[model samples]
Target: MKLLHTADWHIGRRLHGFDLTDEQGNAFEQIEAIAKKEQVDGIIIAGDLYDRRLPAESSVAMVNQMLQRLNLTDHFPVYAISGNHDSATRLATGTPWFKQTDLFLHTALSQAFKPVELADTQIFLCPYFEPFDAQQYFDDDSLQHLDQAFARVVDEMKKAFDPSKKHLLAAHFFAAGSSTTDSETNLTVGGLAAVPTDLLADFDYVALGHLHGKNALHMRQARYSGSPVKFSLSEAAQEKGVWIVDTDQTPVKLTFKTLTPIHDVKLLTDSFDHLIHSTDDPAIDHDDYFGITLTDTQPIPNVMARLREVFPKIVTLSRQDGFSTQVRYQGESGQQIRQKAPMTLLKDFYEQVAKEPLTPQQEKWAKTTLKQASEGGQPS
Candidate 1:
């Protein structure tokens, strides 16, 4: 059976407060086109279908529309699972009737045991689950970490494997030795969640998610399809795409098809004057998301405001010199610091201390707490 593998859609995700609705919609269009061109038997979305557990109403509507186009309108079976960012209860709401139209949405641990049988293949959809979820499912109190939970989970999946058909595992988790980018949330606590790659040796093919770069994991039988759109500055240079897996072959023939982003993420480094002047160049796409690093040793007055006038999509700004540190430590003025949004200040501090951006859950919690603090009330 041939299948188009993709993951980390992160619908409704924004790049530094810039809405990515158009970019995400464009990605779905490309994916649909690719699926049609390839004429695959089915499509596998490994995980992270949405950016947050509590997505906006518009995000929900958009996803519903996109899924309808893929599964109902175009008539392709879709096999998907919930990622860490997803709310399992919300995803499971309409799942009882989803398979009637060839839509298989797996969000719970119990759903993983029963493989979705297709032509010559049995696909085990393993959604992201906490150690406690696995512990409760198995009645094993010792399953305290992700590695331990996955060990038992895989063993049970193997028990239900059909010897006559190819076994494929569609899962969402961080694999041992896999690389990560700024866009991906760390699923580990001092390496507790990293599942050993060797544990997944039994599957004919392992389709993974959570990591945004397709090259994050390098294994003969496993691959990460990655996010179709860039979510962070660190992923500006990463090629975004999907994988076409031909499972009929002895060794699955995997082919990557690139998806064009509506507005590509770009990193521009030059002196402040040069960057401002380059905005007038017709060759430069001022609409594309940009992360700028100024080479000027001295700070420019109203630099961000000036850049915003020329490049309307500048997502991040810093300096190659120590200007960024100067702004953080010895701010231009206390008023300047006070003028920054609470969330922005929190994000800067979190990134500086943790060496990574806050996860969606963390950001949401921070926002809630900040709101409560501003209102002089405690969270209920």
Candidate 2:
């Protein structure tokens, strides 16, 4: 009754237009290795198998290969569901045929509420569904909100509940009190969107997903395993991995297992010059994708291009300079402005109006242009 609980695979996801298939493939390798080492009986991917509704052909191939390795080659039963990011109809394709080999995939509400029984354990798979769709599927017109729909589903499961066996709920929904990251799609319908954790308290163990932060929500035996890889800059520091649950224990023994990635997301802050001049560290993987913040007061020309020479995998660049501060307008006499250098006057004016001082390179160019104007020459 041991199971490897993982979620938010987000396969074929891109970071700053860079393809992450190789990184995701590396993650899958880690998953396979962990499954072997942990010797878990089965696997449960709560939801979000793909990054989008329709994934690329390569992504499809990648998923096919990984599933085959787990279910066919390694002979482990895999139970998966479709998250909000997945296309239910698309994911459900060939699911009937796949189940012939112990690979069970659930998508829409019509398929939910049915328990997949495994050796004295009953696994209830609850896929993501819109409240309206769920209402129609259950033929319950009173289901006006997401919570109400889920409550009805849970009530149905209770009707057929067997007290002697272990009941596990694999769900793809955000529970109240879960920490959310920017990468997740916000269901901003107020109270209609989130479901209370107490509603799912009946199950022995609840394998939940949707929110990207690992340990996002806390309940007795319910937790989100989080995305296997960092999906956004907000998730840069999160420890990405899977959760292992042993049903053999009276209360399931849950263990968090970490997975290593090929190109991990990293955030670095320093002056652009230092980052460009810093030598590559052999011990550290400099090739990791980075979100860099330049602390220089003056902007550097061709900063991205120059930094790429040293840090080729920079994905995001931001300027954290004092020049970005809003300038207060202290009235100065026009006579006093005329006494100052044109470049200095221009820089002050620009900073006041634009809320950002001119870069050193721009100041130099402005000085040259003013000198050309004073000399009666064309300014470039």
Report the number of the highest-lDDT candidate. 1
Estimate candidate 2's alpha-carbon lDDT, on a 0 to 1 scale. Answer: 0.84
Q: Candidate 1 clashing pairs?
A: none
At residue 122, candidate 1 shows an lDDT of 97
Give candidate 1's root-mean-square deviation (CA, Å).
13.2
Q: What is the lDDT of residue 77 in candidate 1?
A: 95
What does candidate 1's lDDT look like per residue over 1-380, in tens digits?
Answer: 88999999999899999989999999999999999999999999998898999999998999889888999999999999999988888878788898999899999999999999876899999999989999899999999988899999999999998899999999999998888787888564347788999989999999999899999899989999999999999999999999999999978889999999878999998888887888568777988899998897655668899999888999999877765555556744778868999999899777765568999999999999999999999986
Per-residue CA lDDT of model 2 for 1-380, tens digit only, reads 88999998898898888888888888888888888899988899999998889899988888888889999999989989999999998998889998898898999787777788777899888888888987798888999988888888889888777788999988898888787778888772355688988898898899988988887887878989888888788888989888999988978889989978788888998887677667764644678889999887654558788888888888898877654322233356668768988777788778765568888898889889999999999976
Lowest summed lDDT window (length 10), candidate 1: 323-332
Candidate 2 residue 347 C-alpha distance from true site, Å: 9.3
Cα lDDT listed for each candidate = 0.90, 0.84
* Native-to-model Cα distance after best TM-score fit, residue 281 in candidate 1, in Å: 3.9
Candidate 1 overall lDDT versus native: 0.90
